[model samples]
Target: MRLSQFFLPTLKENPAEAQIASHRLMLRAGMIRQQSAGIYTWLPLGLRVLRKVEAIVREEQNRAGVVELLMPTIQSADLWRESGRYDDYGKEMLRITDRHERELLYGPTNEEMLTDIVRTFVKSYKQLPLNLYHIQWKFRDEVRPRFGVMRGREFLMKDAYSFDLDEASARVSYNKQFLAYLRTYARLGLKAIPMKADTGPIGGDLSHEFIILAETGESQVFCDKDWLDLDVLDKAPKSAEELQSFVDWATGFYAATEEKHDPNAVPIPADRLHSARGIEVGHIFYFGEKYSKPMNATITLADGSTTPMHMGSYGVGVSRLLGAIIEASHDEAGIIWPEAVAPYHVGIITMKAGDAASDAKAQEIYAALTAKGIDVLYDDRDERAGVKFADLDLIGLPWQIIIGPRGLEKGVVEVKNRRTGQRDELSVTDALARVGA
Candidate 1:
């Protein structure tokens, strides 16, 4: 994409309201704009990153045997009433009313709606052990929404609901989601420790909150430092037994949110006990019949007995991840995007855009990169060399290719690694080869 044609309205000064580094950089980099207190309109650059994150989440979910299906943002309040949570879910729920006077709401979560849907069509044990997921917008009307998308009132979420015949089967389904979340965060270049958490409004005895440690985080977390080196991706899925082994290994670590922290519990050696602020990016819960029983989502068993299906809900904050990622990986210059979720793999900057030789060389490299199926954001705007370089750094593409009259005269272009701030001057072919294009 060409910068001149892109709708990036970058700002020179930070917005006073943005209190965190990710929020500040997002605004200054022209990734998003606030339309209201906690609502934002994602701009072109931000949307690209958001979709990339969503795609990773979707791919991992599919790999874990979860099918995808979108659910509506607005849901009838009747579903909540049927599940006996209408009165219990408090002011955080964004209640609304249609012109016809029917009760409606922007769903904060989909447990009630999904349960109602399952009860309507799924009968008997034949359709048991099903997982349905969606990527959709949700609203919670947080009383004091802050930290940009990290705590926004309106945000995008990847929510999956699983249904099974009994508690044992439900536990298996929960373990699948548990493993999936581990893989998902790893792919996005984040070390998200799954800590036992309190199930606030989404009542469940078994719950885990996947958190990324950040200085600006809202919650205090304790965990073993060894978790940082454990790699779930290297392990292969064998039987349910093997999968359970991996899950047990991950959960055996000493990790818990402040609410669940126990001083006398098995402690990490004092040197390895990590106490830090962390942001909760994903949460999973096995709620047994929390929604199913109340909503009559039951199936006839092989023994001819009818019983409510056990259910679980897993959630990843798709939008909030943009902020969490920045919080986890960034520097004083700007955001340092991970390669997997970067909007573009490379940023091609023509230091002297008006110079015929520099322009031609940049165009050639851009064409070659594009033909090789690379996502490159070309800075073709007529700006000073320093300005272009600063913008490229701010956007934080993994690699930067700098072309100028001087470099072109030497039959070379400068290639820079964003993460390492290392530069090398190589022939155009060598540069392209280095960038894998």
Candidate 2:
């Protein structure tokens, strides 16, 4: 993509309303625009990053054997009534009514609806152990929605529902999602620790909130420091047994959110107990038959008896992750995106945009990199050299190739690593090789 053609309205000064670094950078970088108090409109650059994050979540969900199917942003309130949560869900649920005077709502979560669907079609134990997921928009009426997308009222979420015949099988399904979440976050270059959490309105006894440590986080968390070194993707071709082992390895450490902490319990060694603020990126709940029983989602067993199917729900705050990642990975300059979810892998800056020699050289490099299937953002704007350099750094592309008139005369270009701040003047061919063209 060419910067001259892109609609990036970057600002020189931070917005006064943005209290957090991620929120400020997001607005100043022209990644998003506030539509209302908590609603936002994602710009082209922001959408690219959002889709990249969604792709990782989808891939990990697929790897865990969860099928994807999108549910609606608006759902009938009848389903909630069936599950006996129509009034219990409180103000967080955005209740509504349609033209015909029928009740509806922008679903905050989909437990009741998913169970209703299962009971309508699935009737036998043979079809048990099915996991379905969807990446869709959700609306929760937060009284104080701040921090940009981190606590937005309307956001994208990846919610997966799992069904099983019994508790044992349901536990396996839960472990599958647990492992998937670990891989998903790791792929996005985040060290998310699974801390025991209060289920809140989700109403589940067993729940874990995957949190990424950041000083500007909303919640305080306590955990052992060693969780930083655990890698979920290291073990390939994951199975239930392998997932159980990973769970055991992770749970062996002491980790708890404020809601789950016990003052009377044996304390973790003071030095080992790392207390920090963190953002909740994902959450998993193993609420067996919680919704199924209430919604009458029953399946027939081998003995010809019918019983409620055990179920679990797993959620990843897809949009919030954009902010959480920035909180975890940004520096003073701007966001340093993980390669897997970076909007563009490289930023090609034509320092002398109108100059024939510099333009030609940058175009050549851009063509070569694009041909090699690399996503390169070509800055062909007629801006000052310093401005171009600063813009490229602010966007935080992994690499920057500066084709200045001086460098072009020497048949060399300045290659800069955004993360490391390392610069090297190399021949065009050497630069291409270094950039994997």
**In terms of TM-score, which candidate is strongest?**
1
For each candidate, what is the lDDT? 0.90, 0.88
Kindly list the per-residue Cα lDDT of model 2 for residues 1-437, writing each as its tens digit.
88889899988898999999899989988899999999999999999999999999999999889999888899999988888888998898899998999999999999988888878999999998899999999999999999999999999999999999989899889888888898899899898888777777788688888988998988788888766665556753355567677777676778887776775683667667788898899999998888999888999989999999999999999999999999988788888888888889999987765899888888899999999999999998888888887777777888889888888778789998888889999998999888777
Query: Which residue runs does candidate 2 get wrong by more than 4 Å?
Result: 235-238, 258-269
Candidate 1 error regions (>4 Å)? 258-266
Candidate 1 has a TM-score of: 0.97
Cα error, residue 255 of model 1, in Å, equals: 1.2
- Cα lDDT over the full model 1: 0.90
lDDT of 1 by residue, 118-195 (tens): 898899898889999999999998999999998999999999999998999999999999989988999999998988
Deviation of model 2 at 160, angstroms: 0.3
Global Cα RMSD, each model: 1.3, 1.6
Kindly give the stretch of ten consecutive residues in candidate 1 with the minimal lDDT sum. Answer: 228-237
